[model samples]
Target: MSIEEDRAVQAAQDTVVRETDNGYRVLGSPEESVTHQHDIDRIPQFDVTQEMVSGSGENQEAWLTYGGNYEMHRYTTADVIGPDNVNDLEVEYDISVGSGSSMEGSPVIVPGDPTVMYQSNGPNHIKAIDARNGDVLWSYTYAVPSDVVLCCDDNNRGPAVWQDKVYMTTLDSGVVALNRYTGEEEWYTSTADHERGYSATWAPIVHDGTIYTGSAGGEYGVRGFHTAIDAETGEQKWFTRTCPEEEFVGDSINQAAGTNWMTATYDEERDVLYMPVGNPGPDFDGSVRPGPNRNTCGTLCIDAETGERLWFHQESPHDVWDYDSASPRMLIRDLEFDHRDEVRDTVVNAGKTGWAYSMDAETGQLITRSDPGVQQLNMFSMIPHIDDGRRGTFMPGGMGGCDWHPATYNHETGLVYYKMHNNAQEAWWRFEEFEEGRKYWGGILEDETEAMPDEYNGHISSISAFDPTTGKLVWRDWIDSDTYLWGGTMSTTTGLMFAGTQNGQFIAYDAETGERLWEFDTGDAPLSSSPISWYDPDEGKQYIAIQVGGSGWLRRGKRDDRVVVFSLAE
Candidate 1:
């Protein structure tokens, strides 16, 4: 069939799938997904690489199977913990691993087993924990030469477990697959050259038989990209560079080059993998890489098997405020859009602009836009959000429209949740200055002094929910804070939304009403890691997990590092 014909057909199928009880609806019917009979017989197929269940069959839980749905995004679909009973939540386990940078990780539960694997920052390492009691079953640390130059926080976002093997990326640029039962290394491969300021902190996404991962090195002058590695053999399947060769080079020379520093999601029905890339190098300077930087600072969907680019959408072009496109993209269907008939398969991406852009997953067309309740647009404009907000905008001050942290999708209500801030900072141009051996430039390059806008106002940061189809605000819960907001979001099938903050609090809210359900003081800042949900087969109780660590970018200082888990009192 022609491409247009295929899109039209897919659009129709999407309407049927979404309107009826389809797979992976955040708050939709799980029983319907299991009952519907479809043409594809491979419905039970597991996305071992991305953790998404692909294949045609009535039984595959593609929507709720893995991370984003249950697979790569690591957000949960089980809603055992909700507003009515969230106050019953108590700290079940707290693991203190000395101290680290950003302990950004989500709990990956091995279906039908009590095993859940997670990771930690600072010297990238992986830990297998017993879900019932939080016992460390196995721990593997990949050694980086301690001196590698990394651009952002030194953290391992988490690991993916497939076919009894736990897969994770290291800060030193190595991808390792370990035995789930035993921490023995199964296979390993290097993702990038550490000497050139390239490293891997993203969690490995496994779908089918491939492991998909990206790099982290926009600040120190490194071009970024994403790759698919053979899950069983740890061999390279294919690689897609985020920053395609510049169409033309300019005199200023500072270019946006980094891409694929964050985790990605997969749409099994279409055999497509969606990846979000990061910012360009000299992050604040746009003179080097001009124009809407294609492939970089945008979302790229590829044919999962062939690694061929099907569609690319740029979220930020010439990103002058360090707004990297490396955030999570949630896949959903039956989303209603303005001027469009029926619901369409959609991808919801959270941006550092404090806006959530909804687009047709099959066509890359804009569906809707949303603001995260943050209070800054002038700063975004000053950083050159000038190109009609097409190519990246520095507005809202890129500290986060939503950073690399993950968001949650409730299939029940078709709402995706995330945390955002109202931050504005003025950065003056800094000539290439050698800090020890690392490159040091102002946040965004400007010759003269730029007056940083006052971020001090009514609490401007919030946790928001979006209607992916119409791009309408479902609900948003705000918090009073002096500093810009950080951390991430998660949702459950049972109707709860979880999040953390730089202000030292982990919050639980009503997924439908945005009401504060429960709150806990972690006594430390949680700047990066968002909360994750898992089911305890043994205790039959649902649990929430998060890593509490401080980010220099958020607090302008240091804080403690630890992982905390909560569950209903036994």
Candidate 2:
């Protein structure tokens, strides 16, 4: 069969077997991915070198890492699939991610003799499949202990590849490495004890033979940390506590619960890492955790190799609203602002506070803060106790004006594309003493989705663009839906942005104007994961893929954990 024809043909879903009951409960054997007529050697072997990862922008054939490139720009340069022919894109194949998984991540594509991609499901389950025809190659899993304590819902945000191994962080706090081609376990390193409510939900980024990862469980009042592990030996190279006493504003102990819970952005040129830490413990009852909570609800810039602190900026000082700052920022060089006359290197933070912050990358100083991306209300007022019966209803109820969803940046246009949330919640708090594995939340929230006022009622989210330099809103595409948009946007050089909706719509929008171009309904499941585009040189075809994982809070359709791929119809 012609390479193009083979790629356009939908791969059989049964090409790989999956358990329909519990996600990753029953593991596939080491050689389960090799089909009856499949030859494992058909796929080429190529090293995902450090240089390729750093220069991922130049290599559009694959998505090297989580942020696409170290700069954290999710944009691609693929030109084959674009605005004009996007309408012709059709389903190539759809496969199951097993029964009990919630895929909240994006796939890492590796183009080769037979291009293949690696995907991660909830609680640390991974699978490798042929990118061309969606033939399953291998599967691996690390079942999290039942006694493991969890702060957030169980969700794995995909995996990272370096040299010949694939890396995944587990809900049980294990960072396991697998053979990139064979899916066999090479080594396993536990980052934290799961018995103490510590877990690893964030996908780690591997750089220069070192894998960088951080812990979860800020809600459990655990002291947070980020560690660097040797990719080959699984030895911890460096360890840095996120909230040190000296970094705290008043040397208060309340600053102890900050965790670097999201994937970090790296500046390879300077050998520095930019990471966002989560909110402090007893989230709503801030009276106990006094003084700005220094490193919590903020972004930190540190040395990549040694894990030394460079500079830090606290976004929500004394944050009492559960405003855990987990949004990742882009490290843009030569950024311009309307108020400033000269251009400077800057990091544009799309924070949970619903505002975009442009900061000086060199010093971590605020350059400018743009208008609220969503409705930012009740600015950090003291939370009333639940007994008060005077619950405060506010916009961005813990879910954020921006959540963990990623925003893509277009350096050429200087406009960042983001999926903004317009959510509200009724909240109140109460204090609780620390206990080893128990939650430390000093408050609780009630969803007011039905009582939302007239103005913010129509849509749960909006796809918008902002000029990071001047803190301006260029355009916004409102998505009218009862459910929120869990998916993020990915753009290409062809002047188009692709995004998935919780309602199962895979849409194409004009990058310049936020105009809806084309859309496809991928069954009933929510497309909770982000979409990525890649061009395979041999087949000379560009394709798009996303995971319909549904939300942990609510799901729209029946096909919950499915991988759907699309390409131009033959």
Candidate 3:
């Protein structure tokens, strides 16, 4: 179907469903009208080059990389608004970006031009807005298949900008580039076929002249891969499969699922790109897929120029649990550890197994593994007996120890901050044959009530700070929610930690002491994405921004889809 026809169908479907006060509503169509464009002369356009993005760690004007920098630290040096005056922070501007199923994208401000920011919503809708005021400049929508099978919600992480163009992946497994000034499409290319259960949900990263991205369909038994494309022409430069072909285990190519569903980090000096691979196919039942899955459930480092696999360190080998190492890998350089004599460069990642791992970036060797961040009862236990209708309880259920939320690293204190939840689930299985384009899992995960009492129903969620060098916990604070804390965390140079909760509170904590500093209620909606901060030169103020909307686990009532920016009240 053409793009226009698909949009018309979506609009027609939206008319039949209405949002109620209690939160239940069908998916709505994209906004037809665009926000009136502001005077272009007032906004300055800055050249966003590869060098600028590489050195984005010190960036105070704009957030270029997905994790706020190339190292994926999610830390900012801007300290104009610190803990001293954070209580005075108030909403500066809040603009609705249309009502959608989910809003997971992180807003990226134009380089040197903090007045302009770019964002994307669920269903692949892109928009450019005046950062100072909440006025949309231009918007673009991509056609989506009506019957796409997604294990999660229809979501897009965000976009990558280089030079004068913005690049993003479509819900139907296609990549497109757009003019940053005007939302006109420059080029588009199909990354994979949607019918085969291949999709792209995470943000793509652009370095030099190449754009890098990965596929997302491990739940559908899709053979995952990483692709590099020419940023200028949208031409395929190289493609490397996450699952190695030499190791023929379990249904071979068809059942080997090592999808990359999270944003990757790039090492400019080493010319290596680190990609996080998801779980193998048939998450609960891995009997058919035998042998230690080669590259799945691990971090794969590859040569950026040639797409060659440099090395891989598997976090979970021959896994029975759905412990995907899909979190963003934070690269820390010149790390001195108490255990080791030599200073080594390390990459740290949090896995669903409720453990944090730090590995040598160059050789993929295990540097250290921290104590369990969450409950680990029945962890690594054998798959439950499925001959009868009995169910078994498993800790750190499919939702994850640390899902796709990007963890943050604070350079000032040499500490890593991440959110984790302890939600044990009951599982039982029924063998089934694999079918094309269908959920190919060999069994089902059923709830086991007899295993635990009703009072123990709610999950425990907490935010933890740890030292990766010694695998020691620095501080831990439990949240007041039974639901998982799915949002990302951000640390600032002024010793402040920020994170949004599933219950709609955007919170700030004292980084050193884990004390609650300040919080703002975001309409009681889930802030599933990360929080970002940038300094606005024109106003001499530092603004913190985050996307607030409904997410997969917390979507029940009327939802609000908008980006909220906060700054100290004048």
User: What does candidate 1's lDDT look like per residue over 109-193, in tens digits?
Assistant: 5533443434445445555555556665545455445345555555666777676577778666778777666566677798877
lDDT of 3 by residue, 1-570 (tens): 122233322442352222232112223444441222334344456668877887777978778878888889999988887779889888999877754556778878775454778888666777777787767666666655554556666678889888888888876677889878777688888888877777787889989989999988776778989989999999999998888877646455676888989989998879898989888877767667768878988899999999899999998887667778888999999999867787988999998887889999899999899987877776676667588755667777765688787999987889899998667766655565766666765555543335653434355677888889988878887766545577689999988999988788888988888888998898777778888888888788888889988655332223457899987533
lDDT minimum window of 10 residues, candidate 1: 17-26
lDDT of each prediction vs. the true structure? 0.61, 0.75, 0.77
Q: Which residue ranges in model 2 land beyond 4 Å of their true spot?
A: 1-39, 247-255, 449-457, 554-559
Ranking by lDDT: 3, 2, 1
TM-score of predicted model 3? 0.91
Measured on C-alpha atoms, candidate 1 has an lDDT of 0.61
Q: How close is every model to the real structure, measured as TM-score?
A: 0.80, 0.90, 0.91
Going through the candidates in the order shown, the clash numbers are: 45, 3, 2
The segments of candidate 1 whose C-alpha lies over 4 angstroms from its true place after superposition are 1-75, 111-113, 250-256, 379-395, 430-460, 482-484, 554-558
Q: Model 3 scores what on Cα lDDT?
A: 0.77
Q: In model 3, how large is the Cα lDDT of residue 154? A: 67
